[model samples]
Target: MAETKGLGYELIWKFDMPTTINHIMIMEDIQYGELIRKYKVEGKVNGEWRILTEGESVEHKRIQKFDKVEVRGIR
Candidate 1:
């Protein structure tokens, strides 16, 4: 996948039946790197990660410093 210009952290997401464990909810069939639905991401989640073919809407965040990312999620 193409790297985002300002991606704070690299997360390996997995998909399932939308599991909510420890207050963290993960949607079904939604895998980015190592996370679930609604994550703190920078840049556009398309072109690079083609999760949605057309008319796709991804949730990404524009972060400045990597330190802002409290958790690394995964390697």
Candidate 2:
């Protein structure tokens, strides 16, 4: 993945069926110092993409929580 100037790198995950998601956790290898400084989580709902969680200036571990939502795709 190539990192952009401001956008950074983007990764996506898709599922065949809608899955219930309540929490999301990201663990980065600390050996490389800080890998991700900012991140966002979005989900596809009712044919539209929505932001579920986002943050700025993260370090080794990041955990986000929200109301349980059923999603088929996430980025």
Per-prediction backbone clash count: 8, 0
Off by over 4 Å in 2: 1-8
lDDT of 2 by residue, 1-75 (tens): 122133338767777778889988887888968878778889888778999999975677778899999988788
* Per-model TM-score versus the true fold: 0.18, 0.82
| Tens-digit lDDT string for candidate 1 (1-75) | 222233363445432222222222223333554243344332223113322111222334222232222222221
Clashing pairs in 1: 11-33, 11-34, 12-33, 12-34, 13-33, 13-34, 13-35, 41-61
Error of 2 at 66 (Å): 0.4
Clashing pairs in 2: none
lDDT of each: 0.29, 0.80
In lDDT terms, how accurate is model 1?
0.29
Least accurate stretch of 10 residues (summed lDDT) in model 1? 46-55
The best candidate in terms of lDDT: 2
